[model samples]
Target: MEALGGLPEEAVVNSHVLQFYFHQALAAYRAGRNRDFRQFRDVMQALLVRPLEKDHIMARRLRLMQFLSRVEEGENLDCTFDKESDLTPLESAIGVLELIHTEFAVTQETMETLREMVKEAAVIVCIRNREFEKAAEIVKRHIGKEPKSQVSLCWNERQLLEHCLVCPMGCWGTEVPGVVSGMSYRVGSMTPEGVRGFLEKHAH
Candidate 1:
């Protein structure tokens, strides 16, 4: 907390407040609790995005301003996830993971209303500890007809050491196991129609 001006870089701890709030947001969205979801989204979005900005005005904060600015003008997710050399593996992982998690939290409710918006957006909900199974079950319930797969990201000391050797940046070390293509961010940025198609194709 001392480093980034009283806030952790990502602020997405495994069982922290953000995690709890995220689960709440997802629950609200799935239960069609739009009013609650919006309120929660607004608050959580503010906290989550406050520390992510490169620069901001004091006494007032802008959350997801970059995305908002882009969206207002009909731009897409054009930001690049370049490898930053300075940050340690843990730091980089936390930042990137939190970004993805926050993105999902803010959009989950809206995505429910317009599942097509996330049709091409691949839902990669990482499950570590018991929470993983719970999250997986929830996603399965929501994505009812689609085929879903689970990959383990839990590693012991030795395995982690080995993985770190290979993936030094720790961008996506052995902890996260899955078919990761170096192409898209998540779900490969499919259009709304494409998202629908992905679900349809996977439904069996």
Candidate 2:
């Protein structure tokens, strides 16, 4: 960073510097270094085009990202971006994510990451709104029929919804979450030996 700082302001727009900032921002994002990611991302945005210039679409999108980054970090910050016609907050956020996905030249992995984030967010919003069936459909459409374990930035829906099912009928998500559960049969409780023994016994 110090070495880069030493370069003349005219050098800031160099393609190499732009790529450096973009890669650094991506690295910071993957590492969960929010502040570092934002710093590098802002620099990358400036290199790509004039940032925070309301008249420019790219600038408005970058501003939107700044708000989203805070929300992703569990911050309670108010997001005050331009709302799409008749769209709810969650819907507007999803629209922006899709728009950014189309506009940015990101890798497959990065694009998938952002897609998953918005998908998960949409599911959460659906669940909150008592649209459990909609949430399940969203998961089924893109998340597939296979049971997925919780990963970075992923919600533990299996364990969570399963637990919700175990609770009283008063629970919010017991319906469609359990309705959309995979029918895939597990071979083992914990180990291959257990599965083998059970299979052997059943085979008899």
Candidate 3:
């Protein structure tokens, strides 16, 4: 209690509240009260699904989907840490897919289901992106126009270069075919980094 006193009041209150609630439930369980258990179970279910609606959780889920897609692509996604990427979420997923690719070594016929999972995940990310855009628009209307400095993504040369060199799918490089160009071929060569380099090299 003494140590926690300096912490945020909400954190302290939440901790003590949960602790007291758990104790009450334990006491109820010992007394054979079914209602307390049911309530606890309901609360647990809400906790489980609540985080799934968060942006970071959606990003993780999308990354996993990307990993599964690479398996479908028949690419050797795994290498014991390349000096290439800084290991963002997407890169970490690619690493996992690489492991799967190494272990299973996909054949032409083995990739059908994995391809479908990739498509589904892409759709999910697109939907999430739309939701975020709508939310941003609402906030923008009410809060007065946002500053250009706060925008995390806006397609431009320097921004593109920064994302491509470090981003997992290389940002717009390899992923353009499926979502951007509407062409789906097993392509890992045109990574975002590769595209950025191409532009920079040609800009001269």
Model 3 vs. true fold: TM: 0.20
Candidate RMSDs in Å, in order, are: 17.9, 14.4, 21.1
Q: Please, what are the lDDT tens digits per residue for candidate 3 over residues 96-118? A: 54454444435433343333333
When summed lDDT is taken over every stretch of 10 residues in candidate 1, the lowest stretch is: 67-76
Q: Write model 2 residue lDDT over 1-204, tens digit each, in one string.
A: 223546544554455565566456545554556779768766765665532212343343453444344334322112333444433344445556566556544455655555555555545554444454545555555454534653322245554333333442325545554533432212111112422232233221
Candidate 3 Cα deviation (angstroms), residue 164: 58
Better of 2 and 3 by lDDT: 2
Best by TM-score: 2
Clashing pairs in 2: none
Candidate 1 Cα misplacement greater than 4 A, ranges: 1-15, 52-204
**For model 2, what is the error of residue 122's alpha carbon versus the real structure, in angstroms, after optimal superposition?**
2.9
Model 1 lDDT per residue over 1-204, tens place: 434456554542411444355446445544546566556556655666544433223112132222222122121222222345432222222233335335333344333433322321212222221122332333343343554232222234224323333443444545354433222322223223433332233221
TM-score of 1: 0.24
- Model 3 lDDT on a 0 to 1 scale: 0.35
Predicted model with the maximum lDDT: 2
lDDT of each: 0.34, 0.45, 0.35
Which is the better candidate, 1 or 2, if ranked by lDDT?
2
